[model samples]
Target: MKKLFYLLSFLILTACGDDKFSPGIPDIGIPEVEQPKDVDSVPVVEVPEVPEVDIPDPVIPESEEPEPYRPTRKIGKTYTFDLVEDSGIDQTKAIQDVLDKAENGYIDKNGDTIVNVIQFPEGKYWTEGFDVGLKKKYVIGLLNKEFIDIEASGATLYTKAPGHPYGGDIGKGRYSHRRHFWIENSKFIEIQGLRIEGSNTIQGDLLGTTKAYTPDFWKAGGLDRGAHGDVPAYASYLEFEHGYAVNESQNITFDNCSVYGVWGDGFYLGNKVSEGGSRNIKILNSVVDFVGRQGFAASVADGVIIDNCEFKRVRRAPIDFEPYGATGYVNNVRLTNTYLEGFHGGIAALGRGQVNNIYIENVKINSPGPDISCWDSAGKTVRENWHVKNLSRVRSYGSHVGSIRFKKTNNITIENSFVPIAKSQSKKSMELTDCENVTITGNDFTNGLYIISENSSVTAKGNTPKQEIIIE
Candidate 1:
């Protein structure tokens, strides 16, 4: 029984000795399962599936936004003179303001701002005068070049009287010897449909007399003493009151305008000999009446054209190409379809200055003096190339001698004209003195005589009445 008990203990010890049943050793073959510790543990969580959505961006305020860009230069603009602003008073300041604004244009998306067009309303505007264009240089390499158009249809610019105080000279109460419209050192200016009226009493018939010649009146207004002669007295009194005075300008045009009761010429184109002269000036469809001097006059100019114009009651000739300076000249002038009446002379191109290439076509003159006169002064003889065609209705008044006269000229041609006999005078239709290459043809000189003297060459043919040609 002791042997059986030992064997059983040995068997138990042997079973305990196996590594699979040991306390510190783990089983290698079979996996162990984990069991839950508590019943209140966290439940299983299932994530929900969300649908896709579109969201918009946030908006910004206008104050925080950026502006679009703009260019620097701009094109020419048109400005109209405010009738309300420039009314019932001296319109010099208001008119000048508009001119200045137009001259200095605004900038925008267009081209360079250089040209401007100014328009005025229909009314009577009293002014002292207006001066425009650059008179001196500003910067180096900068030219006084700008284009301006003045559209003054149905507008009248009335000048201050001789005794009235000039606007430029307020305290002095003197008449300034300034033009009504003075344009100098400019290019490409056009003035349209403007009427200019001045306050001069001397008309055609009252030239040499003391009709309105107030010597103390003019002297108190800062005018020089007039000369002794009748015409010179009145002429020197108000010599600078021209309707329009242009100096050293180019490509200027005056269209559909009228000048009445001006003290000086209707238009005066002059330039200093040191500077370049005026060029390409044109006056078309205009009228000049009751002026103290010539209708159109130039001292040193080229390419002047006067077409479809009428001049009446002028103190001097209707058109005068007489340059006053020694080195001055008038060249390349054309007068077409013009009428001259009630004047001292029709057209005169005589001075110490040189005159060349004048053409007159379809000109009708009814005056008391010579119809057309082309001559040189006593010592100097440089006038040449005068042509007159289709000149008719030439009626002289008060026993004036010759209807057409030429002296000391060269290359003259007078054709297709009509001249009536002087009834109470010498009955001379045409006269030539010291001329060269003169041609008189196709004219109606019935009961009229041709007096030729010291002419080098003359051709007279195709004339009516077959009058006798006298050569002296």
Candidate 2:
């Protein structure tokens, strides 16, 4: 009875709590799962730190001022000429006295030949003319206390009569050429910030016509002061190698000056008296107006540059490169960034010697007459290798005549220029006579480019009126 009772109880327990086995048998099924071990006695690992890099600060630079121009010659001394205006003082003589002292070299009390920089203060000083002799490396400068001005009552050097002595001759007996400031044989001459005036209202005599030795006074005709003539040559500035063979004017500069109302040329170079002509001359930032003859004339020049200049109201050509006497050459010349207005002609190069390597660029010309006229040399004169570029006329129409007239020139280039004229106003906008090896390209012309029947070896490409390029 006890065994049946225990079996019934076990069956009841298995059904209620442990159905998978008898009531007490589940406790010993797995025995004991393996126990996990402790990690307290294991070895340790450590990570190293990265080192830092050092950076430096940046550095800055400072600007410095430019040094003043120091002339090569020893001219540590400065001398001033204070002339009295309207004091009945001959300002010419007063200025000439100091110039003579400078040219002759002033000996100090200590027996040292001190070079000087002669300066003229502001005053309306009247002078017939004053001359700067040859072989002077001194600076004839105008003192600009406030600014550079053509002072109404400032240093105005005036000339008196036609044949009168305004200034002294430039050189000794043979090389004597007259100018207000005649400079010759100077290694480095600086003329800056000055104004010169002449009486154009006064009737002037011809330079070569007034010789007493010849009875024929008007034989030379009405040539400009620096005109080139063949028959009974009116060449009088400096006869061909007439004087002592001095060194040509070199390293000379004309800056910030004004020249007006002159019966003669405003500025003249190419001393025929010297074997070597003027070289390395620079004319910059200046104005020349109302001259009876050319604004600037060059007979024989080697290495000349006319830059940033304004020429107006000139009677003859603004620039004349003709060596009137045919003794020297004009080479390596450049006219750049210049303005020309109201002139008969812009540039007329009748140079006897080879007028070669001439470059004219960035020029603006407003003329009522011809702009450029290169005279026909016909083997009599030699001109080659000319480059005219980037030139524009401000006005719509140039003149009744052709804008560019090329004659007897060779190896020329005219490009990137604009000539505003029409075929109705005349057929030829540019005329070339006896010219060869010319290339007219990239130009805007109103009328066509015309060449004579004799012109061979001429190329007109990329020019307007491409169909009507060569007009015989």
Candidate 3:
């Protein structure tokens, strides 16, 4: 019985432990494998630490930024002011109002005003006078900031009777008396293709006219104090009428313009109240006809260039470089390709002020009347010092005023020129009085004497003097 019971238990245990034979009992079949205890037997890997970095923002270019609005024209906006023919109205106030409005218009993004160009249509405009680039009340400050271009093609600006009467004494022993156009304390101004007509009809000497020579006109005009003997009151009366007067300005240009029948100079470049002077003035392709005084006169000026111009029937010299102030000077003047006819003189540099660096080339002088003075002291001190300098190539035809004289001058060079004898007058062709370091070469003095004073130091070479070379 014990053997049968043990065999039965063994059979039961073997059946329970048999693979895939258990039906209802829970079965945890696979056991996890244990890791190795020897950690050095396996290989190990190492890693390095990383550093921190900073990144900046991207940059922007200048072209990518917003641009300021620019006008279509080169300078700025253009303003047009027109007039009617024979209007018989004084256009001064209306024109001045237009100028004021144009000058003070809207400021752009570039901080510039609206006034750059002023245009006038074809018409005959009557005006008393026009004051440009000046303050409204006082004669101070500049009106326009940028350049001003006045285009008045085929337009005439005629002066009214008693025009610009008594402009009320500006300082520096000077008066801003009369001018068809006065440009002061400004720069980069251009007047183009305009005609200016003044009141005076007298061509030659002002004294020759019955209207100007009378004591009533002189007394009425407050010009009687300065007149003495044969000499008219030029200092007082000559300041009363001018086509264009520029004061303390710079870079002013007059192109294709005409100035006629003016009592004073056609163009007067000067300064007021010791305010430096006018500088870099240019007159191109212009005409100054029938003027009472000089065609173009400069006092306290520098860098005056007159090119392709004509001066006819001027009572005084065509060009005068006489400083009116005590501390004034005229420097760097160049006149080329010009025609001067029917003048009292050719060119004059007077006054006590200094005149330096004058250059004249390809100039033709025709029918200059009885005073052809080139350089004179004008009753000032007659010293032996050389105060004036010149270089010229001039040809004088028809009747001349005795000779082309140079007195108290230095560093003169007269070359490649012609000076003929005075018609019906026994005079020399050229005269050098109290001059120094003169070089007269390649000149044709036909049938006329070339006179040099004892006080002159001259070197005459390669000159054609048909008559004698006299040393006075």
Candidate 4:
């Protein structure tokens, strides 16, 4: 046949081109994209252009304000002793230069020493006490108030010897003593129009009665009692702003000046050497003279405020709130616009036990004896709420007035006051006992009379009678 039909058609065209050029196994079905001859000539899918991100603009700044307290020298009449070199009167380098200038001081850390707020430049300051002692809050301060004058030869200003459990009651302590300018427990403390008496003469035991002028001024505060006293336990607050301790020295103060003869006790609030009894004390606008005894006495004190203060001569009770030794009693006390003169017993809030919330307002008391009094009782019995008021009294609590004199006192009030009687309208202005809601209001007593001391309950309003209002 044609050579086996062309060799079987070339082996059947090489087995159908080897099964149409298949290497593994193919049935072939991929090639059909020809439907776009005019689908807008199709070929548009180009979305590649992401570059538009830049944002930075928010700036804000400008503010300023702070400055005031300028002090650039203004202390006149200046003169210095060639900046000190005297070794003679050197009392331990003048009390170690006031205890290293009150403990390493200021003015840009002084190299030689001397703290000047200006005004010591009149000349004549010899110095001593370089040994250091008596300075705990003004061992000395006389910032010129008519010029510093202590020299009757400066009568031995501090000599130093004190040391021993001897805080005072005498015995066991004596450090010669010399305090020219020593400030302790400091706090803007100032002494204007200065005088400073007894300039640390070191004179103890003046003997007014000795256990330090008694009422036990509070011995046993710390209880050493060797010579008979120790006291070291009462210190909460002590302030004498606009000062004038003039003389006699014993923790004193005189505001708005004109203070007289300090032998101690013009205005003495306790603690420290008496063991405890100092509380928020305010003696406003002062003028207390010749303090013979108790011009203003705040006992075991809690809160004592004596406003618009002024007293004269002072024999005993210009104003007193007990508890130093009748046995100590203190709570809350207030005496406003006070003016008591030559006093024997003007305002006396006695103590054996009770004295809480005592308010004597718009007061103008003149006394020979018994203007206003509270007998703080607990002995025979009877202790209760006793509150008097706006008094211009004659005699109150004379017969031992007490809200608690019977161990069961109640609220008592004597308001809008003024009591000046004792032409003996038969005396006895106010005397209530075992009280209970006793209110004697709007009183212009003009004179005297009120003795309700035996199981009382009274309520009298607008106590009229231009001159007299008596009740027994």
Index of the highest-TM-score prediction: 1
Off by over 4 Å in 3: 1-73, 104-115, 129-145, 164-176, 202-239, 370-402, 466-469
Model 3 error, position 443 (Å): 0.9
C-alpha RMSD by candidate, in order:
18.3, 15.0, 14.2, 21.4
Per-model C-alpha lDDT, please? 0.70, 0.60, 0.65, 0.44
Clash pairs for candidate 1: none
Index of the highest-lDDT prediction: 1
Candidate 1 lDDT by residue in tens digits, 1-472: 9989777766776677865434434458786788778866858778998888777776765686566654443347788876443433667657766765666333334434355778889988876433321121100110243577789999987754542221234444343355666677777777899898776643322121123333444434432234222232244435567778778888889999998877688888886866767889999999987777777888889899999999877778878887767678888999999998645678887776778899989998877777777766754665789998988766633354567787778899888888776557776777778788888888887567654456557888888755556777
lDDT of 1 at 432: 77
Which residue pairs overlap in candidate 3's backbone?
none
Cα deviation at 132, candidate 3, in Å, is 14
- Per-residue CA lDDT of model 3 for 1-472, tens digit only, reads 9989777766786678874544444667878799989999887877777787776777765677677666543456688875556545667766666666665234466665444788888887876433432223221122443477889899887753323232223454444355677777778778899898865543232221124234344334433233322222234434547788888888889999999876678888886537878999999999998776788888889899999999877767778888775467788888888887544557777775667777788777754442235453563433232222222224433343345676777787777777766445565666777778877777776656645465888877776664345677
Give the Cα error of residue 423 in candidate 2, in Å: 5.0
The residue-by-residue lDDT of candidate 2 on 3-39, one tens digit each, is: 8998988878777885665745546566678654868
lDDT, candidate 3, at 146: 42
For model 4 the local lDDT of residue 415 reads 71
In model 1, where do residues sit more than 4 Å from their true spots?
A: 1-75, 83-88, 104-114, 129-145, 163-176, 201-235, 397-400
Question: How are the candidates ranked when ordered by lDDT, highest leading?
Answer: 1, 3, 2, 4
